[model samples]
Target: MKKFWLSLLSIIIPASAVTFEDNDTVVLLGNTVIERAQKYGYLETAINLSARKKKLKFRNLGWSGDTVFGHARSYFGPPKEGFDRLKSDLTELKPNVVIVCYGAVAAYDGQKGLPEFLAGYETLLSMIKSSASPREIVIVSPPPAESLGAPMPDMREHNKRLALYSKAVGKLAQKHKLQFADFFTTLGESKGLTDNGLHFTPEGYQTAAPKLVEALGLSLATGNQLQSEHARKLREATVAKNKLFFFRWRPANETYLRLFRKHEQGNNLKELPMFDPLIADAEKQIEALKKTTLSLK
Candidate 1:
């Protein structure tokens, strides 16, 4: 019985002792996109890269259906845990970079005009900035939502505000001289980086993590980069074959056709599935390619 208790303690001890290493706490704040990543995903890999240096830890504070600037912590409420932890979380981790993703919720029902939204957003940014003293921050543009399917009239209008809010965030990053991850521009190319219209899948994280990794200056060495370049082309060939399979199967490959259209931004580590099975299949192949490429080093 004593041996059993000691063994259990040994396992639980390390898990409990874990406090997300220093310098790279990588505080990710936003909506479900950030929240879902708590499970195994690319954000894990990105943190791993960041961790390779100064002991990285991922602190998730994503709240679903929150707005970028509507002061959600007050009215809309927060996750059971609350993003307010940013203050204490920062005090403890002193994150090297804070990546924020909170626009989708604010865009939802808030009748506030653009200026009001921006003001609310600015306050949030201020809170985040002040909390950490001098931690680096990255303003990630909220990915577009599938507002077309929502029943609420306001939900219909939310995406526009989210877009505008993203623009304002860009300005804030510039003003603060913080890192701006133009996830809007980079992710804007596809059907806005998601399949369910909102919420990321395994693939969405795959697409965004590398960009965030690069944004944080967590670049792999030149030797690794050179090897990655060669591996990338072989992966491209794999994608081309997947595209061929789609063309060969199903209704003139219309679904596959839509996949390319929706997943045009499929490169750059995107993991979201697209309009067709064929296209989605090709994406999976590409994903495998990325794993193999990254493994070379």
Candidate 2:
């Protein structure tokens, strides 16, 4: 059991920036947008598919309605406690690369909260740097909300504010010498992308994933060969691997598992560690499928 645990922990390792090394552990941190990404799997798929030469690991730590100040992650405690939890989580992951995405929700407050938002953002960046010391940090600006016509407020004005926030994020990235991806500017018109003004439709994430990959100086294997049945299998395998990883890293019902309420139902927490082996199996399957897919060409 000891040896097994050690091997499982060895899953995450350092990687290169221009392209991923075989053992890279990439962690995605942000808000609802990032959380929702687990369902679409476009971003993770793009990364895995684009990384033809190596296998990479990904862990998404997105919390719905989370802020730069760690609002959503705080549970019943203060935001500071949530911030500390974020730090601890990153430290545990020991990621080689971290993609930080935030700002859309903060932008809702408009200009009134921009300064505080930026400050908190910077602090969050610093904390991440201090905790994980990742090899590369890529900051992604939040996507603009669309005008959904009804209960949703006009997103034209919201988008203007979002631009400002995105610009601020870009400036911070430059100042900190980190890589930057501008989802805000790149997403362009909302159109049919979002169901409401704030969140994305599955199609929206799929459409945006490639742009993000491009922005990060990565390239996808897009050709007639990729349209084949084997290619579809590879895509499915990628999604399965990512889903297993998501559960391995970010399990649900933490309030009764890892938090204050654990005293009541913590015994069931044994199930959590079971995800590690499952994730490993999925990753190995992905590798096997990738080899078969590529060999066919």
| Candidate 2 residue lDDT tens string, 139-227 | 88888888978787787887899888887887788778777777776677847778877888888877777766765667677644345
Best by TM-score: 2
lDDT of each: 0.52, 0.78
Report the error of model 1 at residue 116, Å: 2.6
Residues 66-141 of candidate 1 have per-residue lDDT tens digits of 5653234332244422346445545665666677765556555344665666676677778777777545666666
Off by over 4 Å in 2: 1-18, 150-152, 223-231, 292-297
How does each model score on TM-score?
0.54, 0.85
Residue-level lDDT for 30 in candidate 1: 74
